[model samples]
Target chain A: MAPTLCELCKTTRALIVRPKNHQKLCKSCFISIFETEIHNTITSNSLFFPGERVAIGASGGKDSTVLASVLKTLNERHHYGLNLILLSIDEGIKGYRDDSLKTVKRNAKQYDMPLEIVGYDELYGWTMDQVVEQIGKKGNCTYCGVFRRQALDRGAARLDIKHVVTGHNADDTAETVMMNLLRGDLPRLARATSIVTASAASDIKRSKPLKYAYEKEIVYYALHKGLDYFTTECIYSPEAFRGSARTLIKNLEKVRPSAILDVVKSGEDMARLVPDEVSAAGQGGKDVLVVEGEAYRAGGCGSANGRSSGGEMADTERQLLESEKAQGNETEISHLGQKHDRNCKIPNRTLRKLPKQQMGKCVRCGYLSSQDICKACMLLEGLNKNRPKTQIQVSVDEEDNSSRLTRRMESLKIIPAEQM
Target chain B: MSTQSNEAGMVLLEVEFTGGLELLFSNQRKHKISLPGSDEKGQPATAAFLVRYLCENLMKDTRKEMFVMDGTVRPGILVLINDADWELEGGDLYELKENDNFFFISTLHGG
Candidate 1:
């Protein structure tokens, strides 16, 4: 085939080899278009400093891997003089984390970046499996979530970096915007759409350079560049929560190509009209502000100790721990009656108490806690209330129950089993 | 009705919004509103009544009247008084006489 003209620079050289759509450009020019856009994003947002240290939260995922590659490229081309480090949080989930971490390490080596991997077990004292085994199916995400977030923040802090960047993309932001709207979360919808980090937010200003980038484009970019990325989803995801949001976003996007842009535009518009209550550089009264439903935390030191976590732990932890202490908290509660001892409660408390409204309900199974019996137990209470009709199981093998439910759910097509 | 000793005195309305709705309302103009009004909290239809009553009250009273909603009031906020800024008075809460101004601002946050 004759060499096609470059889309951006009109170069007649096939600098780009085998672009998916026969798109042609000299390697340098084709690259400039993409690189320049990233540079613009960083400069416009002031996401990086000339010599300031910045940490990238790499997950070995398409978005993150691309972010690392582009940031490195931009740092060199734009001379942002950024000291960039790759920070990967290993949640210690079996296939999921181990595989992803391998990619992160490889990418770090390829990019010649300094890399740091903080394990869920090391930071939070428990992996997803152990947490699941101990805490059981009622609230599996509780562990990885609280632990993963703080793990990233703590990792950034350990590096003594001034900024932390994540791989959140346009799709993710749009999904979140829709999620907030459906839930009537005006503040979050107003605040979450920016392509840059709120440099004003203190405690290691977190950002998302990919907020405007499309997920499809990111995946395509990674594939085209032959970058390593993990294809597995989090193992314990039941597809009962954010899964719905993800699906909704996908559907909306299919219906309207500009759905993501519209959502982001709305969020931006709302932000302009809201109070000056933004937490700038983590200073000001808004700096101390906290919101509900958003439990992602800036990791701090000694996160694994259990002693550092506050309210979330007290409620979920104390209840489970106190119950387990009496009934071998080591023992996992099952869908049916059986038990396996597991050790974890500190970080789970952070999960439970994330939203005061949610915490008032039992974390065990998302129910209002009345007296000592939370919703998880309350479900059993209802079962027992059936007298001879309901045979209840309070303590059992945690994994077994979840798997059982997972299998049943698969059979019923409630969620595709492969997703789990 | 022009008694200098208006025993009714000034009525103050304090409305605290739910979340980050405070930054948007920073542009309100501190002006007179002379709407004869109602003394209540979360009363529906307060926007129109407030605009009319506050306009009439402040223009007539000549006392600096204000509407105190959280800084995150919604767009299209009907502040038919002056500019709806309480900065001239005591920030969000304005001082006044009877028939002073009352403004309705919207703030939205949920779980």
Candidate 2:
């Protein structure tokens, strides 16, 4: 086969045939275009301000690693005047997170940025390993998902930063949109489609600068540029519904590469069509922003970390479905009336008065919550209650203290274990 | 290197796996292997043949599905033939050449 010259340069041999547009480009051209598109996403959305203290949610994985590298390059090239820092959430998984955090530490030195590490053990008194031990691996993703959302927020708060950026690319966003669509969650769909989500309840604002970059492109950028990144799946992740959604997205991409961006565009268009009252009701009016961040953050963490097996959205949908089933008759009658009369104010008023969650501060942790105690506090309560029993069990086996000591040492070791 | 000149019916190539796919290949990122110069039908070996060849000869991991699905390289894994996307080089059907570099990177791994 003859060598194909870059479409843009028309001189050098093309190394990449872009998936989205079939635009052939050499290595340098592709890298510059990838960074430029991210720049476009950031500037067009007004993601950051001059001298803004922003935290990059680094996981040491490809996405966040590429995000940190690109942001640093663009900041210097465009004079964005951003004070960037790396904020890592240590889920404290024995073999997985420990190794990834090492990459993140190196990235801090390599990028010349300050780094902060927050662990579930520090914030919630329970590491994910401990949580999995207490409540088995069956539904532990719920605990991790709820915990990481608040972990990121608290990590940012500790840095005294007001903005956080994540590495959620177009593929991740498309998967979330598909997950929401599958679960029939229009309100969340609306929230998930936005590039930036901020809440009045919390001081921090979160955005995805790589929101439009393809996963393939991100990997290519990291590879061509020789950016170091860790690439291991979380050992505890049980392939959940999101896995299916992800497979579907990849298959669709194979058939038509533009399908990803098209789905994102479609999601945004659909979000705009969502009724205002429905979105308002979705979060109890003014607290939609915080809840929006929660939902969006959970979607990313759920898919990226593979932490949430059923996903937090799926869990919430299940609960909502059960409750709706309980009041099925009343809702069915109201629905029938509304169908008969599109302008029926009585049904609308009753629906509006259906006891929406009023956002407030958690009494214990003082984080924003619709319930008296925030989700994290509520989860911690359960884990705390079970802590003593596990300790007692461990104490009962104290005659084997030497073996137990070795086991503890093994778990705490930083080296990646041969087997998960 | 001396064996390469003596073996007329074999081709040597370099293969790489990253983005977590290395875990499926004994946790090694790079490997060089010599393969048959032609497929079962005697046609020049292609990328599709190399995938199957690697699975049979190179891969020690039992989870074959992680690397190949439905008789093809899985969708999320990117294949770069000599630093160029395999998509541009005729995808899986591109004929293999001696000393060609085939890189497989999985995008499925989480960030």
Candidate 3:
């Protein structure tokens, strides 16, 4: 077979046939075009302000390593004047996070950016290993998801930075859209599709600069450029549902490479149709809705790197739907004055509305929460109280005991469901 | 073709796996394997033949499904023949040449 010349350069041999458009290009042309598109995403979205400090959420994975390298190159070339730093979260999972963190440390030196490491042990007095040991692996993703969201915020706060950029590409966004769509969670779907998410309640802002880049292109960029990255799956995350969704997206890409971007665009279009009242009520205390005319961007961490799996979410959705159906049936029975009226149909308007979430701070730890105690504090309370009786006598700090008691009392109060 | 002849009618090629695919191939990224010049039908050894050969001989890990599924390279894994996408090189039917380099990278793994 004769070598094909690059379509763009028309001189060098074409090495990559881009997945999104099938535009064939040589190695150098592909790299420049990839960087140019990311720069375009940043410029068109105005993702960064000149002379603003931004933190790259580094995981030493392919997405992030490529993000750092591209951002650095673009910042210099376009004179974006952004102060970039690498911020890493140590989940304290042995043989997993430990190995990835080493790659992150190397990336910090390779990129010549300052790096900050925050551990769950120092922040919450429990590493993920300890939490998994106590809570078991079944629903630990929720703990990790909620904690990592706040940890990134706190980590940025310690550094006094307001914005953090993640490596969530179009593929991740599409997957999140599918998950939310499958669960029929429009509010979260609206939140998940935005390129930028900011909360009025907090100073930290999160955005995905690679929101438009295809995963295939990103991997090709890394390979062609020789970027160093780690590639192991989290040992504890056999997230069945997400794994399934990912497979679906990949298969769709195989059949039609444009399906990913189409899904992302569809997600954004559907987000615009979400009612203001529903979106207003979706924000947890820490995540305020940013409504700009018909455009609404709410703050929430993307589950791309977080361990939150679709299985737990699917279970929650099932329970919610069952309860709602039961309520609808009961309403029908009460209005019709019949115990078993199978013929009577429940009106769609009669479906119970999600309760409006209140914004407040945890009384104990002072973190943002809808309840008097935040999720981390509630989890800590559970962990602390469940400590073996023998260890309780050895280290019963008064501060810890008093907070535990306060949280216990708070738990007794009738707190609304879906506090987190 | 005569100049590229190898001992015992076998063709030597370089194969590499990355993006966690190496974990299945004895956790080794690169390997040099010699393949018979022709397959069972006396046709030139193709990428399909190389895949089966690797799974049967090179792969030590029991999880064969991770690398290949239903007699083809998994959907999410990309195959590069001589640094060009295998899709451009006639996909699985591309005939192997002596000293040809084949790279397989899995995009399904966590980034």
Clash totals in order:
48, 0, 0
lDDT of 3 by residue, A1-420 (tens): 688889988999888988766778899999998898788778766789999999999988999999999999999999999999999999899998999999999999999999999999899998989988987886666567657777888899999999999999889888888976775556567667777777533468899989878888889999999999999988887566667778888888888877787677667656645544444444543233322221111212111112232234323222322332343343233333322434323222322333335657889878766567766677777788874222221111100111222222233322222331
Pairing residues by index, what is the TM-score of model 3? Answer: 0.80
Against the true structure, whose lDDT is highest? 2
Per-prediction DockQ comes to 0.01, 0.77, 0.69
Candidate 2 lDDT by residue in tens digits, A16-45: 977777789999999988888788667756
TM-score for all models, in order of appearance: 0.50, 0.81, 0.80
Note the residue pairs that clash in candidate 2.
none
What stretches of model 2 exceed 4 Å from their correct place? A286-351, A354-356, A387-420, B1-7
Please tell me the interface RMSD, in Å, for model 2: 0.7
User: Once superposed on the true structure, which residue ranges of model 3 sit more than 4 Å away at CA?
Assistant: A285-356, A387-420, B1-7
TM-score of chain A of 3: 0.76
* Residue B3 CA displacement from its true place in model 1, Å: 96
Question: Of models 1 and 3, which has the larger DockQ?
Answer: 3
Each candidate's interface RMSD (Å, one decimal) is 21.1, 0.7, 0.9
Error of 1 at A209 (Å): 1.0
- The full ranking of all candidates by TM-score, starting with the best, is 2, 3, 1
